[model samples]
Target: MRIGVLALQGAVTEHIASIEKTGAQGLPIKRVEELDGVDGLIIPGGESTTIGKLMRKYGFIEAIRAFADQGKPIFGTCAGMIVLAKRIAGDEAGHLELMDITVARNAFGRQRESFECDLEIKGIADPVRAVFIRAPLIEEVGPDIEVLTLYKDEIVTARQGHLLACSFHPELTDDYRLHQYFADMVEDSMTANL
Candidate 1:
């Protein structure tokens, strides 16, 4: 399977490395046409506002939404999670608005407050290492959304069909299980369509 990392901003290389660890071909996607070559996409952590602006400026918003409409999986990490959120606390507009969740930007506090922890993610047998840096929190989720991992009683990871959102940086760690999980999602999606 091939996976594409939305290279608009944030942790693109780390995400690519993690994807490659799963024995999948990983590519950086900078243009809309690049979307056609991948079975899955990962939007890495970064400044949500900037990523949103760039997505709109480069016409990626519609292209990405269309890609997801095909039932392919899309994983969003940290700021990328915010991008996928249908509603953001204290904000009127949201980017992509694909995932059925509400997010609070920087709910983990500032950069100085960044921290790491091992989290018990649903569907994974062992705890996964997580790094939160100015991360958002999933305050609410739709009925279809499944809460996956939580940190300190706050929702940090969730899934809704083919979409996965995490408020922590999974790519930043050596553990590739989460990436492998996403790859499996992509593969399953491909199989279901066939």
Candidate 2:
């Protein structure tokens, strides 16, 4: 399956590498046309506002929304979590409003406060080592969304319909479970369509 990584900014190469390592085609999506052939998409960690601006500037915001509306799976991480939230509490910039949840950007404080911790993900058997780098926290998840992982008494990962969001940087870690989970989701969707 082909997956597109939003190449607007931030950790694009790392995400590409991770996706490739998962045995999927990793397409660096810079333009709207690139969205046509991908089965799934990844919005990597970066400055949310800047990425939002670039998304709009490059016409990727609407393109991505259109793809999501078509039932394509999307996995967003870190600042990407902010981009996918329905509402953003602490930030003035807001988000893409894809998932029905509220997020607080940089809720864990500054870069100096960034840390790593073992996360108890709901489905995964082993603890996932999650890296939080100025991450966003899920302040509220809508009734339909499923909470996947939590760290230090806060919600760090969740899924709603075809949209999956993570507050920490999974790409920064060696763990491929999250990516595998997303890939499995994509595979399920593909099989269901058949």
Candidate 3:
């Protein structure tokens, strides 16, 4: 299986390392053309507004939206989650607008930047470890969205069909189950298309 990490910004290398641990070839997607070579794509943690501007500047907005329309799975972590959401809490315009959810940027507040916890994701058993650093929170989810893991009654991880998102930095931790989960989604999408 092959997976691509959005290389426009964020923890590109770290995500690649974690993806490789899942026995999948991880590629860095710098250009829109690079999207064709991967079965699934990951948008890692980074500043949301900057990532949005860069994506627009590089022509990834339409390219990635097309990629998702092909039924290919897209996983967004942290600010990446913000990128996918259809709504942002403030007046900030949404980017990609792929997932039917609303997100609050920097929802964790300034005091708890390095908060860690074990979360019980919907699919994965035995609670997965999650790290929150300037993470966004899923304020509300539409009917299409499936709530995965919640932190203190707030939505942190949720999946909608082929698109998956997490408010915290799942790539920062050693856990690869979330990556595996996304990989499986990609693999499944490939098979169903056949």
Off by over 4 Å in 3: none
Task: List candidate 1 stretches off by more than 4 Å.
Answer: none
The number of the candidate with the highest lDDT is: 1
Model 2 bad stretches (over 4 Å): 91-93
Clashing pairs in 3: none
Residue 149 lDDT in model 2? 80
Model 2 residue 47 CA deviation (Å) reads 0.3
Q: Which candidate tops TM-score?
A: 1
Which tens-of-lDDT digit does each residue in 1-194 have in candidate 1?
Answer: 99999998999999999999999999999999999999999999999999999999999999999999999899999999999999999865989999999999999899999999999999999999999999999999999999998888999999999999999999999999999999999999999999
For each candidate in the order shown, give its overall lDDT on alpha carbons. Answer: 0.95, 0.88, 0.93
- Candidate 3 residue 70 Cα shift, in angstroms, is 0.2
lDDT of 3 by residue, 13-108 (tens): 999999999999999999999999999999988899999999999999999999999999999999999999999998689999999999999999
Compared with the true structure, the alpha-carbon lDDT of candidate 2 equals: 0.88
TM-score against truth, every candidate: 0.99, 0.96, 0.97
What is the RMSD of candidate 3?
1.0
Collision pairs in model 2? none
